[model samples]
Target: MASWVILVGRISDVDHSATPHKIITNRDYLAHPALFRGQRPNVINLSNNYGYQSRGYYASLLASSRGHRVIPTVETMIDLSERKLYENALPELEQALNRCRKELGGEIPSRLTVFFGIAPSKASDRFARLLFDWFRAPALEVAIRDEKGWASIRKIGFLPLARMSEAEKERFVACLGTYTSREWRDSRTRTQARYSFATLVDPNEELPPSAISSLRHWARVAEKMGVEVEPITKKDLARLANYDALFIRETTAISNHTYRFARRAQQEGMPVIDDPLSMIRCTNKVYLNELMTLNKVPVPPTVMIAGPADLEIAAQTLGFPLVLKIPDSSFSRGVKKASSPAELKALATQWLADSDLLIAQKFLPTEYDWRIGVLGGEPLFSVHYLMAKKHWQIVNHERGGKPVEGGFKSFTLAGTPQHVIDVAVRAARCIGDGLYGVDLKETAEGVYVIEVNDNPNLDHGCEDAGEKDVVWQRLTQWFIDRLERQGR
Candidate 1:
């Protein structure tokens, strides 16, 4: 069997068009000229654009120089025009690869990898489908880097025959059998399966149907790709050692079960999707603000308030018409805007009564915010979120009433501003590597970090209705690829 290693580009590193050339040169030096005596090694380059200017061509040139074979997996254009029909092409991609392996004397290359080169110009429905197909193979190694420079070795699926000892294989197979049995039973019931997956939130907590819908969509996608996804509750977290991976559905804090699961999963050597360290670092507004500032990333002025008095002082200093938020909430929950001293005082008082900490910052009256999804540290997709009508928050519920409709409008990835991309990457680096959503605001001054969500919702019908399916598809593929690497 042939041995393989996968490398993904750091999305943040390639803001200029010339960055791809830099990456190609680095790969060539590391794997060919320096390590392999100018001999080419098998490489797979994954990217959205298929144009001649794309990274595929860059990979081909590098491979040819090293006298090695390079496989260019050009991802199809993801846009409103092609979003809904992407999944239909998965089987074709898989079949093509299987055929290639068969023709290569039945010896599949030991390393299959993916790179999230850059954010797409548009969100594609088929993008997710393509990712799921790529990850379905148990023999793939996955690495991801986001638009920011943060990079991580996300997962290694099945061990290559050349790398695994007989004892290691036996132990892995035993663990697999246990996980498979649980998956089999969980798949039979929605409730049971959901509770069996992983604990991001308390299973007993009454999640909004919107949240449940998102979870179901992810579970369905995982099933379609031959992975069993079930919800694991806080009470059952100790059993994490039995699984190959853990999937989290929302942002969480250091005190939450989701973080606990991540810590445990990492210790056990299981690939924890979304990752615990990522959650702890991203969920805290204060931490994100400080990190961004330290890294010279543009961020709005922010103050952390520990009590009502502290909030009042901060409010007076920051001025009215500011944004106030809890340290660990997503989907615009526990976030509010204060327009006057009286309003700020009252809101601060109430918030302090309910939470231990709050963040007060100058509100950038930008009409829209950007939600950039960084998977395995790579910016997979981005969408512009317009504030809800008659509401200041993007996904806020009414005052003691149900959520209002038409509060958000999503634009294609191409529509996002360059500043949004710059600020997003800067913010993501502060949060470390994993899967995350970098929320940003473009003010007159510049782009600022509004919040960094560790578990940004991947709801099927949320902000970007057109790209919801694709988001899940890419996410599923990420998990699948990670698992393959871990097993390897």
Candidate 2:
């Protein structure tokens, strides 16, 4: 976990003991870079003035350069200072304002104070959160007004601590306490480690690729490799700049926070598994289907459905018992099997409401699927994912949406078939090489690529069964090598 520090232009800008985190003068922090050379801390810039090239602005600027995560980042400061930059955000802000108009009561207040994403009034809590998500600042004062028949955001500006009333200061303190306490991090200390690693996870995920036990074991392995590991969630987005590298353990989607985390890590120049490019290519089956076919990678005969005409073509071409998939299906959630023409049309019409395109492929029934783990364009491990009981998929969700997974058999690289390993590596290379699980179907004819998964499962005793300690060691080294290459 990153150590926290509060930066202020003047000593009196904030109460000395208002927060448990360390407090330091802006000048002292700016003057002494050696004091924080090796460690990256979370710097809350409560500096008094943020004018261009001012002490406050430079504090945030230097914090970012030194790899410390700072609130009211340099970009945020520049965006708020220029009206044009913030004007584009007005529509969303207006929508949020209107939603809370009733709770705000009568005419929307001309102005409201927000401290650390918390509004003084309980009714504006969600609006405050949205504001914080847009502008990461210690405090903000938003101006609301009547635009025709609705509430609109007129202007927004920073709320200086020096200008806050005593009551507002108390509220700020409480909000700061609440904000800093949201992360559910492990308490173990790794002060001696050379680098910091952030493992992004969702504790409440029903079927997270990596279990908590697996994460703990990886943390232990990381410690032995002189790296510190911490489990972070979406709430820690503001703190991402402090880490040297990121490993996403949760399921990923282009429209979700996991993708946001991956993009942020890349922007920070940190090595991240399941990088944004890999997610874009792996998450969408439409893109993968075209990519594989173009690259000469063997895959099932597939048809892309866009309208009723295309549906008819797919039904006639692939025939009965074909699989239909939405672009972003995962864990067998948005995939369905159609055994007849009517079933195909019914399923396609309903699924098309959400997605513009769908994939229809010849159903190649297999007792098991060959999942080959590939790391950095090299084969890592292999597993046979047996089909669920009386089901054709590895995971069956037919019973009330609860998934029942099948058994898995792990194999060493030498033990796995050379043909399977070669095909999996070829498919993974079609997408950028980070970490991938290339799922393939083996029939009497040949092995065909099914799907290339980004952020594949690394659960303890599952993927690691083949190499165990060797797997963990290699994984840790993969991160370290990238960090070294980037001169982190």
Q: Using TM-score as the measure, which candidate wins?
A: 2
- What lDDT does model 1 reach? 0.52
Assess every candidate by TM-score: 0.52, 0.62
What lDDT tens digits, residue by residue, belong to model 2 across residues 1-488? Answer: 55888998787777777777888898788656555777888889998887644567667766754667888775567557755546656777778877887887756788988887888888888888888877778899888788676887778899888888888888889998887876522211111123699999999999998998999998898898898999999889878878888999999986567877776676557888978768766887876776687567899999978668888889788988999998777998888999988999999999877665689999999999999999988998888999999999999999876789999999888999999999999999878869999999999889999999997888889888987778888888998898787665
RMSD of each: 19.9, 18.4
Candidate 1's residue-wise lDDT over 1-488, tens digit each?
23232223333322234222223333333233345543334443432222322233333333333344433321121101122223333344444434443344544333333222111112221322244333322122333222222222233332232344565444433432332233211101001111124425454444332276567777787777776776666676656666666776534554445555665565455566667546545655645665566567887887767666676677667887888887556667777888887887788788666554568888777667878867766665676677778767666576566665333455555666766766677677656666677888766677777777776655565644646567777776775675565553
Model 2 — TM-score against the truth?
Answer: 0.62
lDDT scores in order: 0.52, 0.82
Off by over 4 Å in 2: 1-194
The true-versus-predicted C-alpha distance at residue 397 of model 1, in Å, is 4.8
User: How many clashing residue pairs are found in candidate 2?
Assistant: 0
